[model samples]
Target: MEINHLTAAEARVWRAFARGETVDFRESPDEDPADGGDWGAERTLRAGVLRALLLDGPRQDGEVPSLSVAGARITGRLDLQHATTDHPVRLRNCHFDEAPRCYAARLRELNLSESLLPGLVAHAVHVDGILRMTRTRFTGTVRLGGARIAGSLYLESAQVSAPGTEVPVLQLNQASVGADLSAPGLRTQGQIRLNGATVAGSLNLSDARLGNPEDAALDAQTLTVGGDMLLRHAEVHGWLGLRGARITGRLDLSYVLLSNPGGSALQASSTAVGELWLRKAPPMEGTLNLRRAQLDVLFLEPDSLPQEVLIGDLTYTSLVPHEPAERRLPMLERQRDGYVPHAYEQLTAAYRRVGDDHAARLVQLAKQRRHRNTLPWYGRLWGLVQDVTVGYGFRPMRAAGWLLSLLAIGSVAFALHHPQPLKAGEAPPFHPVFYTLDLLLPVISFGQEDAFAPSGGYQALAYVLVLTGWILATTVIAGVTRTVSRQ
Candidate 1:
């Protein structure tokens, strides 16, 4: 129905939409327009200068269709309170110079695509269909607090300019979305807050450049996503805070460059993700905080093939035990390149818990290689010895050396205690030779009287000689046994 004629109330709404003035429904006349069942449909409100005031009460379904306010400069509030639409509401290329309020409006498939929106405000705005805003430019604060969207919300190529002129930027606080929130190629100069927003589908921010060196950037707190959160190739010049955010699927951050040289860069505490992929990302200048984050096996796979994957700082439980040399060597080698110091520390801690101090120290040393090779040759030799002793179970040479040392000590103690008897034509036995033979030998035999006599020292010498011969024979026998076994 055509609404060319203006009653006092209709005239006020027309003047508000035309001049961008805020209409205070509380202060307006008490006449109820819907009581007469005459809500205007297909209404056109053209160019006007609007100011600050409220517009209350609900509008009938299909009561407003194809409302166009093209090229109009909205300087104040424009509240479409509790308004429901059956068809798409188009507001193409409208310039909002001041804060425009549209609280609790039920908009189905609203199209503000390519609109120059600056300082726009929408609290509790429920959208049923797609809210398409392709290439829209938001220069000041634009809020969508407590809004619920049922379909895909596209903000493709939208440029949210810096908030320097006493105004803030886009905010979507406590908003819930049923489908994906795609914002590909979004360039935000000011902060874009999406705190406590829930998304049923993926949150795609691919190729989005956010924040400036002098201003605050994206602040997405407690954002819960059912699907993957893709931020591939996105560049954040300031802080990108995602504290307490939870993603059920993988958090794909491949090729993302987050540069906050002077401030905290990326903070994602208590965040949960299936896997966090950071393949080919540039070296982060600031902290990439993921404190108390849970990661799965997909994040721990080797970065090369037959196991080719991206290698980075990862914190996870040990995949190998402390005793197996074969299993631990591969993991050690993986830390040779791209090893984050904190991740290496985590790995070492896990190893230490399994009583694998040698492996723990090895990883620590490998991580130190990034800064300086402070480990000396002797230190590395000691580390190698410890590794072999704990990991390989190869300590035959060590056992043999200890056994020989004990025998030498015992022989010396016996020689000093008992003096040799002077034979008529023979000289006293040489002590060194006796001790050496006793240590090197494996068998000894002596009569009881000879062992107890003053001449027992000579007998001890004889016992050492016989033991040396027996040890040589046993070695020869063992060699033959091994050869026969091999054959």
Candidate 2:
């Protein structure tokens, strides 16, 4: 390709490429292309000319070969598929007529900040330095699947929208970023997929607004992040699927608004993170599934809780706010499944770790109550009896109180009506308290019971005392046994 007979803008770009100088067409750095400026052939450059300059450009004596064009219009498809370029391409504030195709291409660095592009297809592209698109707008899908970036991939304040399409607007599936993949304040109308992607540093998407009403807005299943995955204050209209993801650092979702009615808002099942911050977020519209996920610490607030949650086998070492069981039990009660005993047990353990034995006991009691709801009527009745009598083996003082009450009742009844002696003068002295004790003891004979015989109602009363004594003894024994076994 002869680089002669080029337009003024193309000639300037060719000259600047060899000299490593930026060819900015805008009067001001912040001026956009649509800000009342003529953008005809005077400011237009064919993509092929730029591609030729990058591939076979004249090298100056001392200056490095680089392509930096700002506030210009690129007319043709910048197809650099399978091509290798050593130049750093910075096309800031530019408008592209067609999407650039950099499939399987190797480049030093690429920055498309503040540019308006129809789309991008850079799948399997290798960037030695950072791949930046800060404040850029993409009207079509931005595919970066299987790409490897040695440095960070920045997309801060970028807006990507594929209107009326079900496909992902930004695809980073299986892409490997040696450093951080920061995209704070990103806005997208379609899905943003990062499935199986690996980020050596943190992956920040704070203040992002992702919308995909039909499907998941952010599908990051199996994604691995070495540092924190921050999504604080994000608004996700569709599901945010993080299933099987592994994050070495904390996963922050504080103050996020998730909405996906009748479906899962956040599907983080089987994910493993060091810490999970879900504080101060409003009530979500859909289920928050954390089934089988494990985290070192879980920062959750009562008001941030969703209507339903799947916490079966979700192991978290600690809970934030350190609230009492009364406040935390409500969260466990919202389990998606009918009743999950593991969630209650996990909450109980968390309380115990903080040396809050009272709170731990309360959680244990709540667990039993929840479990009782899933049983048959007869079983529930039995559970209720145990609960009312001794708090299901958690309140031993209730047993002591019942024993004293029964003792007093038996004594008063026997004292009111004394029994007749069996063997006249040889009978032991009649003591009402001892007689009542003898009837209630079941095993021990106080001699007063053997010496006298109660007739009619008194005899019936004595039998009633014996039956009540047996019941109390059985229940007390059961409670004690359960308590010991738990300890």
**lDDT of candidates 1 onward, in order:** 0.58, 0.90
TM per candidate: 0.58, 0.96
> Which residue runs does candidate 2 get wrong by more than 4 Å?
34-38, 441-451
Query: 1-487 in candidate 2: lDDT tens per residue?
Result: 6556798788888888989999988867778744422577788989999889889988999999899999898988999999999999999999898999999999999999999998999999999999999999998999999999999999999999988777789999999999999999999999999999999999999999999975899999999999999999999999999999999999999989999999999999999999999888889889999999999999998888888988999999999888867889988888868688889889988988889989988888888888899899998988888888788778879877876777788788778887889989999888888888787676788898889899999799888878877766666778788768877
Error of 1 at 247 (Å): 0.6
TM-score of 2: 0.96
* CA displacement after TM-score superposition, residue 28 of candidate 2 (Å): 2.7
Candidate 2: residue 40 Cα off by (Å): 1.2
Give a tens-digit lDDT track for model 1, residues 138-233. Answer: 767667878899998888898877556533467787988899999999888777778899999999999999876544567778999999888889
